[model samples]
Target: MKYLSICYIGFISLIFISGGLFIMSINFLLIDFSLFIEWEVVSLNSMSIVMAFLFDWMSLMFMSIVLLISSLVIYYSMEYMSEDKKINRFIMLVLMFVLSMMLLIISPNLISILLGWDGLGLVSYCLVIYFQNIKSYNAGMLTALSNRIGDVALLLAIAWMLNYGSWNYIFYIEMQKMDMEMFIIGGLITLAAMTKSAQIPFSAWLPAAMAAPTPVSALVHSSTLVTAGVYLLIRFNILLADTYLGQFLLFISGLTMFMAGLGANFEFDLKKIIALSTLSQLGLMMSILSMGFYKLAFFHLLAHAFFKALLFMCAGAIIHNMNDNQDIRMMGGLCVHMPMTSSCLNVANLALCGMPFLAGFYSKDLILETVSMSYINMFSFFLFFFSTGLTVCYSLRLVYYTMTGDLNCSSLNVLNDEGWIMLKGMLGLLVMSVLGGCMLNWLIFLTPSMICLPIYLKLLTLFVCLMGGMVGYFVSYVNLFFFNKSLYNNKIVMFIGSMWFMPYLSTYGVIFYPLFLGGYIVKSMDQGWSEYFGSQQLYKSLIKYSQINQIVQNNNLKIYLLLFVLWIIILLSLMLLM
Candidate 1:
């Protein structure tokens, strides 16, 4: 007989993935057993590999989340997916993705571990474009390409580590001897993380990934992809705690949080908006990575996973029922029909807004508290405040644009509350979104003994959330000066809304970065010519001459390769000099 049948494949995959989680969970709880090791020789040194099948408290906690989300995604897919003839293939890929995530959760060795990471990346791209549409395919392609840059950088970092420290789990714990090599490697790792987590300049690909199915969006945005970057930070926390690059991560993450929050508002596509919000949330998580509390960061990941998945799934249902329309303007007043979905959507929104007693409130509040105390001295403290404000704006807009607006519902309601299968999967998460903080025992994402100074700061975050929701609700509830336009279309509006600076501020920030850079070079050349040869005309002739010279420089892969090699050599020489 074949290895499996169409019907039982998903079941089998789920079982194996669950088995991995279960094993890891037990290990976490029972810290007595040593990690299981698998040995292999890489560069002639025989390395002992540990399969962290045994669960410790930490691994068990995270694996539980991993299992739950993975299972829910699987269950939801049962109903979410149309019963295409090739259902088996889809199930297989889903299982594959689950297997990859499970492996990633407990990966003890970098070599085998990266395979799991890449597996998630591959499946995410494939699943995003699963429907094989023009837009989805393109989105998948670009997203995969962007993620690969991070993936490759991570691999490079691993190579650097292998040369310096032994590739054991304890290597990061003893990084007091880090030298220039480690710093360079650390820089590359941060680069990998920034790209993978969609920090700032690398933020565009995540929004494009909205073309994927809703489950994919939920998985990618919530924990698996973006969290991997945070996870990397946590895993290597000790090594990165006191370094220039570490400080730089803190700065970049804060800026990223602020920018992503801003970007989320600028988007109109439902998924893209959430995608940007995910980036913002991940930025927050990354910012907190170097703090003393790893558990806080981890709990935030859990809470984020719950609500973000719920919201994305809800958005998917809205999109699916509304005949593939993703624009919010086209989808007002879905609450009339999708009552359960709308309710769940509201819960998720409230949770994301960090309304009191919800899951997000605890985590966001803690971060705010931490910021006030530890992060105030990090410079431009107002950026974090603005980030919080923008989180309100974007998350509110997310809720307002989809569920509460006018019933522009031209498309027939084809879906009914995501049905029982999906609902069964989401109900637990929805309930948790509602009362996640109260049920602390079950949701063991955070440590019980965290030394947080929980005072009025928590209340302030709750207040912020409340106000944000009310603002959004009011905007969506009453049609007050309705301007049905996207920020991209509203160029002047984008300039103004992006905080009052237009001409000089955005000179090269977005689409024209390359052109602005080239123009700056030409201007510099003119300045140098004037300084040396006492003439601007000389620069003009030189520009014309370069234009003529371009004919000889055009079209040769060999020359390009040679230039690349020479540039790399020069770069290495500079590093040596440093």
Candidate 2:
């Protein structure tokens, strides 16, 4: 009852705040009004420090969406974490997470942004390790360390921004394009964004972070934490677009998208698959932003948040009913047992695939059409469309594995969609997933973007989606001949299945050589040469000198008389010399 009251209070308050923010965002958009509030913190010679917040349409709308999702997630957690002893702690952590995101969204000062950004990292680490298991601890460590790279980069960027006599990056974005120091700042910012978004080399931590609880996954990984990078890039888009750095980012993000989509197709863990898909969509956003389409990226960001959160929540519900089993191979014919969850999952998946009139369709279709119109290289173009198809392939494959076929679990298990609280939470996002795309398109863009393409070019997206669906559906069936063939080519299967060995590379590939060198150094220096020539030698010499002193100081009459005579002779010699 105490936990229920906490949940209800948070849910109701956040919902009210979200509604108010939504209205304010719309008004801001309509009137082209933005409010910037600043407080002077300190002033030094030729430099001043100030904390600032920018309440623009973008930030307001994003905050509204974040709060709305958080409210639903809190409501959902009432039932999800009801049996746990620390449900209140979980709710508080979630609220802290949301507060950090809000700070990041509003802050314009680099210092304040860092505060918010670091808050996000710290809170996410706490959430990831909430399960208090080895897997969760490892995942939390990986997540923290990976994001620390970005935090370091952001710190460097902040230091570099000191050269401009201000940390308000918004004022210097245009000036940055012409200055070398500012350009370096841009590079650092991009690096930070990539680490946060899990682009390419930084991508390994994202799927590994699935050790977090489902509600955490829905709120942090799916919506807020991962999107921080893209949001940073969006804020700094002017510095990157049309530059060498932008082109480099374009390639990297393209590869990231392709890698994530391919990896998702081979993944069996339900949460990890969703995490990879989130990575893929982030890549798409980063790619478009690199091409100077910040609005489109923002559009897709919002749309993706709705559906992805829904997808994660549905997965959580399914996992809950399945006795905490996340392996999709162990799940089948779920549509019969958990029809509401299956229906919501399918809706979210299709929206992810950009089915027409769905939330994803609006932004994804625009992005593909715009990419088709752009004059990018063949490599990137191919990556763009191919990755799109792979998205469908994975979505269909997931649907087939979970929603169709014979029941794969033990018959003794009782499964049903009886969690009404979970269902209500899912239902809210389900509506958004179905309608968010079109609504966002209308709200975000005052004038619609124009795309001029031939019939075949325009139809390419639909064609690839169809083909990918067919492949995904057919590939779900296990044939003995193909299975044997796959077994024969185990190395290839392993490579593709394991995200091209990125997780291993991120873990062992990074630390193996350094650790090995440290071990060698310990053997040769600390234990060997340093011990023998330094500490051991010093100890022996001290012992020898001590023994000599002890012998000289022995209380023997003859030795004492001889030493006194020698001292008298030396004194006489010294007196003669004087």
Candidate 3:
């Protein structure tokens, strides 16, 4: 609570405003940043903060992605959230969410970075339960609780680094000097990432997070929050390049990919399906990350961010127009009715399906190619092979359910793409989703491996896509012939999916079973925040505490002064003790 201050908040917003325009300005800003190339001078310049913050193309690009999605979420919330009575607070919280993310992206020291990292975990959980009075909290609760398990692991990893080897992140630039404890810590960090990113057993929270606001669903689940775990892995990738733990992470990642794709195939809700898609893609990225291909993983991150956000928004628009309806069974024949939104959804879907000219193809295909260089690439190759069809199948399901068939029976509100704000954001994102992937050089600082796959691989991927589409079409055709509950239950496919249960089978499992675990989380959260805020209100009312309210609400000078004193003592103590 004390952490929320105006200057801090404003500084974050400006960072977002600046970070949002990151990619657009990166190539152009090289000269502006070139003068600070010397690390000593950069450190001196950073003396203002103690840890010299030097700018790099990679960090800048990451900041922009964080800002761009966050700003758009805020901008879109104007329409999506404006009518809600709590809109102002929601907007403020949203900004805080992004600001924390910005802090994590740019920090030079591990301690500095972890401050932002933990902030993301807390803020994201708050946003997950933003709509305090719904079943959505169940999903939000699950995400919050599961992410915390990962958070605890991450803390241990960070603490281990700080206490042993005199290793500060400032020295990460010199990797060869790190000790055995560093390698051990690196493994723990991957465990943390696996939990954070919804990598396998953790995959369930993402689908459950569908309970949050649609915009949050887009911003957190798709573009940012979920990706932070993977982003952490990428940022620290080179530091742990040759460690065995890194290879162990690759195994977790590969299994997560298969699990996510399978689960999405059977999922029926529009948003959850896309949410599951995010898990699958993150798994693919992690797999690439484990193999030490940072560029491929990061490129997949960018490409997935655009298309995935587009997918989530498309889900939101459908849900919004239907008056909070999310079950696909409740929607149909919407294409002709909501032309603009359906159009945008279609464009994003095309990119997601890796339609050749769209943004997703360039990045996703390159990831597949790069992984194929090693033995494990076979896992990616086949997982994607099946995923190609699953992606097309589930994606087409959203379009099919919303627009293609006769409208289903769920009572719907009068469909309206009423607000220009939502429309403008969707249209703009559609453009970016289509074109953003082609801007590859800026995709990663590293050059990509050339595609050396035999011509048959392209043919194989196409065959996979066609078969998935045909299977879906055939299934749809069979549905008309005879409706049977058993057919909808594909046991063989489910069995293959059980292979992913390796993490789950351990006596102490990483994957929490039962989606309901997340729901209880929501009820607990509401109780806690309610207790905290209610007590604050009661204290103010009884004590003639206007000054207290002013301090809490105004958030200017006094709080920052307190923070300054607190940090002074902490840092001074650290210097003395160490």
Best by lDDT: 2
Q: What is the lDDT, from 0 to 100, of the residue 75 in candidate 2?
A: 96
Q: Which of the predicted structures, 1 or 2, would earn the higher lDDT when compared with the native? A: 2
**TM-scores for candidates 1 onward, in order:** 0.76, 0.90, 0.77
lDDT (tens digit, per residue) of candidate 1 on 445-471? 434455365677545555655665566
- The 0-to-1 C-alpha lDDT of every candidate, in the order given, reads 0.69, 0.92, 0.69
Off by over 4 Å in 1: 1-36, 39-55, 175-177, 378-380, 411-415, 435-459, 470-489, 495-578
Clashes of each: 8, 1, 7
Q: Tens-digit lDDT track for model 3 on 53-77?
A: 5356666777676676666666666
Using TM-score as the measure, which candidate wins?
2
Where model 2 places Cα greater than 4 Å from the true spot, the runs are: 41-49, 478-481, 512-578
- In Å, residue 106's CA in model 1 sits off its true spot by 1.7
Candidate 2 lDDT (Cα, 0 to 1): 0.92
lDDT of model number 3: 0.69
- The TM-score between candidate 2 and the true structure equals 0.90
